[model samples]
Target chain A: MAALQSIKQNCKKVMCIGRNYADHVKELNNQRPKQPFFFLKPPSSILLPDEGPVLRPAGVNMHFEVELGLVIGKQVKDIKAEKDEDALQYIDSYLLTIDMTGRNVQEEAKKRGLPWSIAKGYDTFCPIAGPIAKSKITDMHNVEIYLKVNGETKQEDNTELMLFRIPRQLSDISQVMTLEPGDVVLTGTPKGVGPVTSGDVMEAGMRINGKEVEEAHIKVE
Target chain B: MAALQSIKQNCKKVMCIGRNYADHVKELNNQRPKQPFFFLKPPSSILLPDEGPVLRPAGVNMHFEVELGLVIGKQVKDIKAEKDEDALQYIDSYLLTIDMTGRNVQEEAKKRGLPWSIAKGYDTFCPIAGPIAKSKITDMHNVEIYLKVNGETKQEDNTELMLFRIPRQLSDISQVMTLEPGDVVLTGTPKGVGPVTSGDVMEAGMRINGKEVEEAHIKVE
Candidate 1:
């Protein structure tokens, strides 16, 4: 109920979901996953608010993916979603975050059957906004998320477009790794994901029921 | 340094090196990587000392890959390892750990270009022993590591076989994700990796200069 800020410190692991949106999957020419495709970015990759510019590493094609972040408030494991709904209880709050990725490096790793750590685990790779209390978000399933780079809108979509929604994502992940208090899960990004260059000012936010609730601003350097 | 016995509580992330040994690369039919191949396992996956049996999930071909774990003692980033040295200062201690893997799950994920989170990150997957102080380890690069399933040797090798040794591993990793105190690096596994079934007892240990230092026992259930 208090201001659950200090995301950079409270967070442990950043669990990420990929290919959860149809259009986004098509844009990347990836098969629509029958199950949730998961990966992780280290907490060291987090860049807190006012932490300064996000470094665009040399020879890297950095891409921006804005998504809803679920902050786990309790320790839960083996949560089952057996045609009923009990998975939402694990989520303490929500936030807006950018799952910054090094596209070129990621492609190479994928082709070689290697891990995607370096591609997504660089310092300043993950940037976040408000820990909008669970009480504030009326319906997380229908919330709107969008991203803008250099004053131009690039990605704009609603959570309704997500292939594997929040409850399923949380339930599935909990079956493998225990979700602890402060662990954050980045629900997959939506369509219109694109690249960001140095000196680019990127802005992203979340809106629930037409009310702007959370926002994040990051500059590339 | 005091006894850093509570590994599960103290650790934040487990950075694992893949394809770091010539024989291991050849055994897995993987090409030698020009650069370090990295991935991560969540802290929740850790099974501490005296913790019960390591659960082998149903339908999963759980395999054991014994490795030397390096515990980072200092916060380091962008560490440069030239022809000389200096990377060893970051390591606070060492340990023996089994990087339990779901071979079938991993193979499916790899073939599909998916992240190996679930394949390699199930609960009770990482079983470790000893935070042998850095002072006790005369030479981390030359120590021997071995593993036995049901009292039969499966993997036995020296750290000297690692294609990318410690200093290089720490330096290269720091360049991407800042290595914080208590963070661990599982310097890849060796050859002779094989599947472990239920009712199997795994005994693994480390030897420095032919003297036993750390040993871990895990029972499969």
Candidate 2:
């Protein structure tokens, strides 16, 4: 029998960015897009109550790519990219997400025409940290998402530089999917995404619009 | 507060195939994998209801893909490309699913190195037909998944020519993500994927092993 269900911090889908940061784009030698780019990660990929070094699943060389997140409050669909504010009628709040990737597997898989899911879809691959209410922020743009290892910042970038702003991307993204309440859209990351060995203590911080809201930390085994 | 819930056919993830059918590989001039290839379609993509035609959301070239689905019965990870029996043991049941696609959006999105959730993760994109018990199947290797429009079969293929058998593909897919109860793994469709226009009738059927177990038909509006 199908179980009845309701929303508890209900996140409908987790969408992510690709090559949004210029340095990351330059590092990738890729051109900017006329629109925002996206991919998906299973919600099961979340590592809640996370502790210690996260277990990297097999079949991919998982890497860490930190990013800003938008948690939608209502269903938004079919909005034009240029007029993203029209889609804002649906967004509820925001979040912080880590889009862990299996880089090697992805390179190989895409080359062979396979989808990147296996390379990125394992459980605990997408570790999310916050859903701070929308009212707590003043600037959605110009916020910074940074990562640190044992208190040493490793990667940092401001939302001001995103190739596609969150509101615009949200509008574009909603055109293809009906983002229900709680769905998280991980806006692309800034450069400095690299490999992390086991035994690393990591902290990811988010500055919504401008003010830092939350910081999530964990240690590697 | 979180909704108190129990899962029914609850799967942590649902991995799908872009083109696992032999004719499909041939048509695209793509070589079939000795190992089965898979991708992810978040649970949010599913349109679960009595019976309906999954919508072709805006800004997408939504296409239709017919597939036989495997439901995991046990938790499994790191399964080999060979161990057939062990692979079978990991599965709990089987179902028939229609993997709806936004073909144009997918191509455009990927060319930008974007993720596919926008193209594939739209709500109601996944239309499932059954939860047929494991005991009902006759032959996993030779069943047929047929897609028809207005009572004409547009896609019809026997599992015989699949590059990778179910056992092998399932095992390989589990290697990256731990398969949990109710999770689905779609064994690819055969050649003959085409577009579906409005006002069309779509039906999905399966011959588990050999005998027909479940089928559903819905008209597009």
As a whole number from 0 to 100, the lDDT of residue A122 in candidate 1 is 94
- Tell me which residue pairs clash in candidate 1: none
Relative to the true structure, candidate 1 reaches a TM of 0.96
Cα TM-score per model? 0.96, 0.84
Per-residue lDDT of candidate 1, residues B45-157 (tens digit)? 88877777788888999999999998888888999874313867777778788999999999998898888888888999998787777777777778788899888999989
lDDT of 1 at A44: 90
Q: Which ten residues in a row have the lowest lDDT in candidate 2 chain A?
A: A1-10
Residue B30 C-alpha lDDT in model 2: 66
Candidate 1 residue B62 Cα shift, in angstroms, is 0.7
Q: Give the lowest summed-lDDT range of ten residues in model 2 chain B.
A: B1-10
TM-score of chain B of 1: 0.94
lDDT of 2 by residue, B37-128 (tens): 67778765666545355776655676788888787777677677464455667766666777787888777655544456656677677777
TM-score of chain B of each: 0.94, 0.85
Quote the true-contact fraction of every model. 0.64, 0.44
In terms of docking quality, model 2 is: acceptable
CA deviation > 4 Å runs, candidate 1: A1-5, A82-85, A214-221, B2-5, B82-85, B214-221
TM-score, chain A, candidate 1:
0.94
